[model samples]
Target: MTSDPEEQVRLQGFGEMTLRTAVATLMQLAPGERADAAIFRVRDDVRLAQSEIAELASHWGIEPAPNVRSPGLVPDQHWPDVVRGMVREAPLPSLMVAFLVGMLVARR
Candidate 1:
């Protein structure tokens, strides 16, 4: 969206400041070489991984959305740690588990 001039300006109004504007403003304050445009996109297959995680947690008697915090089970706070521990204990599905946990953490 930042590539298009109009969209860049519109994004700024929406508080999604464009990198182009930030770089330009910075350049004026401190002289520097011309800046380049950079865009980033993140894609995650959360549905599949989350399903797998829930299935695993269920086997461990940890409800997918557990309310209580307890050892060897899902905790309300730092719940992602519980998920990661389960993933590490299992020999299989390590990659998928890591990805799911990462997606969960990043979203939070």
Candidate 2:
């Protein structure tokens, strides 16, 4: 809530860095009894952060973009099914992308 624009930008940058660090730490943790708990904690934190960001944006008169989808695109409600179908249609490519993402995240 700093009035200075530079301070606000710095704070936002720091928040992003912190979130990325948390995700990187989570990725490094070995899978075990604790991993599920950690994942849930991160998920909740992310949800909270998202809500906070939305509130802040609204306060600043920044409206979110409309959810516009082109013709033939799957509806928002059917995203899960669409993703499943895509994976089913191209499992190898999906897996490769997933692997590459994991590697990139780990590198961070």
- Candidate 2 C-alpha RMSD relative to the actual structure: 17.0
lDDT of 1 by residue, 1-108 (tens): 123222232111123334344333323331122122222212221122323323433443443222434565853568888877877787777777877999999999
> Number of backbone collisions per candidate, in order?
0, 0
Top-scoring candidate (TM-score): 2
Candidate 2 per-residue lDDT, tens place, 35-95, comes to 3422112223323243444344455555544444565574455888887887788869778
The true-versus-predicted C-alpha distance at residue 51 of model 1, in Å, is: 49
Q: At residue 67, what lDDT does model 2 achieve?
A: 41
Where does model 2 exceed 4 Å of error? 1-5, 8-48, 71-108
Model 1 TM-score relative to the real fold: 0.17
- Against the true structure, whose lDDT is highest? 2
